[model samples]
Target: MSAARPARLAVGVVSAGRVGAVLGAALSAIGHRVVATAAVSKASLHRAETLLPGVPVLPPDEVALHADLVLLAVPDDVLPGMVRGLAAAGAFRPGQILVHTAGAHGISVLEPAVEHGVLPLALHPVLTFTGRSEDVQRLTGACIAVTAREDDEVAWSVGEALVLELSAEPVRVPEQARPLYHAALAHGANHLVTLVRDCAELLQREVLVATSTGSTDESMVGSASSTSAERVIGPLLSAALDNALRHGDRALTGPVARGDVGTLRTHLRELDRVDPELADIYRVLARRTAHRAVAGGLLPDHAAAEVRATLEEHR
Candidate 1:
């Protein structure tokens, strides 16, 4: 695409799912002309109407035909086929900007369209889409990671403009880094769900056992009853995350980070006694933390050596 003049960009959104509808609406609300969308589900159609008001629900090909910018918010696995189909159907107009919102993928999936002279880009918001109206609120003040082909400056500018219109910060990430970035996000948010569920089940079992024994203290019951899992974990995690983000890797403060080898050994012994399967997890995490501490210059060479030795012995 030519980078001379900023085009009066007309936007078309394909796959009117949660992310697509919310963003299409947000773009429309910001005075960008959202020309059309392709919504497959009734709920998606309802969301499209809510967001885009009277915008037409057109076919996928029509979306590409009408707009200068096209967004593909479909499932990740289906994206390549969709782009190839669009390209085969002559849907991509020359210089049209085609962007997808998949975090795990880079702009390479849009290679078919790129060959057709379409500028490929990616704009992934670092937030989950829960298909709730509140998602619109969540879109504001979010961080979106943008990835574009090195040669496509116009597409990059369009991605930045979209972020600005949404009141979100855009960070340019390299194409090869997309998968690792997405894996980090999934490890943090998705794995936390499994971890929290396991904790909740354990707590419930403990509570039931205590109740059956009729030895549960009133104060203990009250504390457990009044504080939810989220209440207990959210603030603590938020503070740790804040420290990690603002103060860098040196902000790590657990036993491993502090080179408290004896404390780590004690914890590993306890885990082996209570849950043998968890011992490996403890060892691995402690080793990782030790590496981080060493990298941050928080641990001396001797201390790092000791930490690694302890973790290896436990493993």
Candidate 2:
């Protein structure tokens, strides 16, 4: 049996937030009709106007009443109450497909709407959104994690069908594993941004110190120096990322990995002088990196211990 209920189904976005607005546009591109959506904040309203032109901005219940497929793209914490409220309001109709995009949850969160006879599904896009037209194209080749109700073969197929409609790959994730899956992605992607920004800040300090003598002071470092620092790190960082992804622990090549205790001491002192918090971050990450390198056989145990001691004593 085909998973999609019908061709050209009317789609309703509960709120045209960043993920919602762009996905509404994507569906519209692939023969689905975005009949209506709910938008409250000024940014959401602007996003709807830009991405979902001609689609009516209706209330959540009204949008639900009008569509065959109701997409609930609100935050994770609010979804449960929102579903219960809509079910209580008689918004869900029998045979309507209810899908949510929260990564942390699966079909369990949509159980309230099941009473209204809606087919529940959890379809999470593994990529971030910018609420722009470009995101529609970026959806191509991206992976979407789907968790459907157990024993509901039809719903699982429907979820995959929807992902295929968007030109993305679908990976089935068991309901129990959703939280761990979400955590891994967040730890890698979200924390990478914070780590990169910290590295750029450190590089900026070096650039500032080099371009100006000690008399100039840190306050005088401007955007030009910041840009220069980023430019200097950009390609190097890009190659390092590529190598790390392709070669794994074999890509470990630095003072810590090489057991250069003197170099590690220098880095600790420099980071401490720049910012105490950053020095702590460095110590923590370096310790983790050395452990992983040793485990992977990239560094001997003795080398790792020496690196650890240098990091521990960098007072």
Candidate 3:
């Protein structure tokens, strides 16, 4: 028999942190009833109060008892224990759906709830939450990754409906691949912040050096230079990202893509003279770029070999 149309269910949110509160509020705004939430911290409680005004803030067990769908928005480390605790407490009713916002975990963590007739799903929004009502609006048009061990038809429809209700796109990912997918996201987005911060510090040092040299550092000139840098860098980076997304590795540019040995050598020499630490990063990235370009048909095997040899020699 086809599963009953997944009801417009009442949702219970556990852990009223940024993701929990924002999602609860967004679902509520989209006409789902957020019946209860568990706010563990003072900050979380305040966030819940702000985002889910008039919604009862209950303990985890109480939330599970009151709602048909439960969202475990707790930290990844705490999720297994929390799920076990709920199961032991007889919190989930038969046929209830339980989900978590954890990207790194799949449905296995919810195994404790499975015997209780609870359907488990992993629904991770790709966008970051700002712990503000504005995030509810921002969630629209975002992308969410979903994985479930339940019937594919039911799981996919439920996930798609929820994402559509939130005005976001739903990408179905395999359960076993979720961790690796999450790792890729973390590596690109999270680590990039550290990289940018380092770049900003280097730029500030450059500014200080220019000022210290008593160069004709007019404020207008500095402002113009900063504006030009922003304009050029922003579009260049955007174009690079667009090309990567559209054409994959084939759209790579610069000396590495061209397999210019002299240019690679000059880059290493410049980095060594200015910042030896960055030289290693440059070399590694350049070598990878060359490999990708070669694979993408942008560079011949011999050219790639020459570039790789140049980088390895410098290293």
Which candidate comes out best when scored by lDDT?
2
User: What stretches of model 1 exceed 4 Å from their correct place?
Assistant: 1-8, 41-46, 187-223, 273-277
List TM-score per model, in order: 0.82, 0.92, 0.87
Q: Tell me the tens digit of each residue's lDDT in model 2 across 174-268.
A: 99999999999999889988988988777666655566444455655453444566687789889989999998888888988888999899888
The candidates, ranked best first by TM-score, are 2, 3, 1
- lDDT per residue for candidate 3 within 1-315, as digits (tens), equals 124234577999997999999999988887789999999688999998999998899999999999888999988888999999999999998888888999889999999998898878888999777788898898889999988874667866776677777888889888889889999989888876656555555555554445445446577556545543334356666787789899998789999888789988997997787788888888878887888998899999999999989988988
Q: Candidate 3: global Cα-lDDT?
A: 0.83
Kindly report which residue stretches of model 2 are placed more than 4 angstroms away from their true locations once superposed.
Answer: 4-6, 212-227
Q: Report the lDDT tens digits of candidate 1 across residue range 1-315.
A: 224334457999997898998888777766679899998789998888887778899999999899988999998888989999999999997878888998889999999898888878899999989766688888899999999877767667867877877888888988999999999999987876766664555444554445534546777666556656566566776788789889888788878888899998898887787667767766876787888898898888789899999888887
What local lDDT does model 1 show for residue 12? 96
Task: Choose 2 or 3, whichever is better by TM-score.
Answer: 2
- When sorted by lDDT, best at the front, the candidate numbers are 2, 3, 1
User: lDDT of each prediction vs. the true structure?
Assistant: 0.82, 0.88, 0.83
After aligning candidate 3 to the native by TM-score, how far in Å is the CA of 299 from where it should be? 2.0
Predicted model with the maximum TM-score: 2
Better candidate number, 1 or 3, judged by TM-score = 3
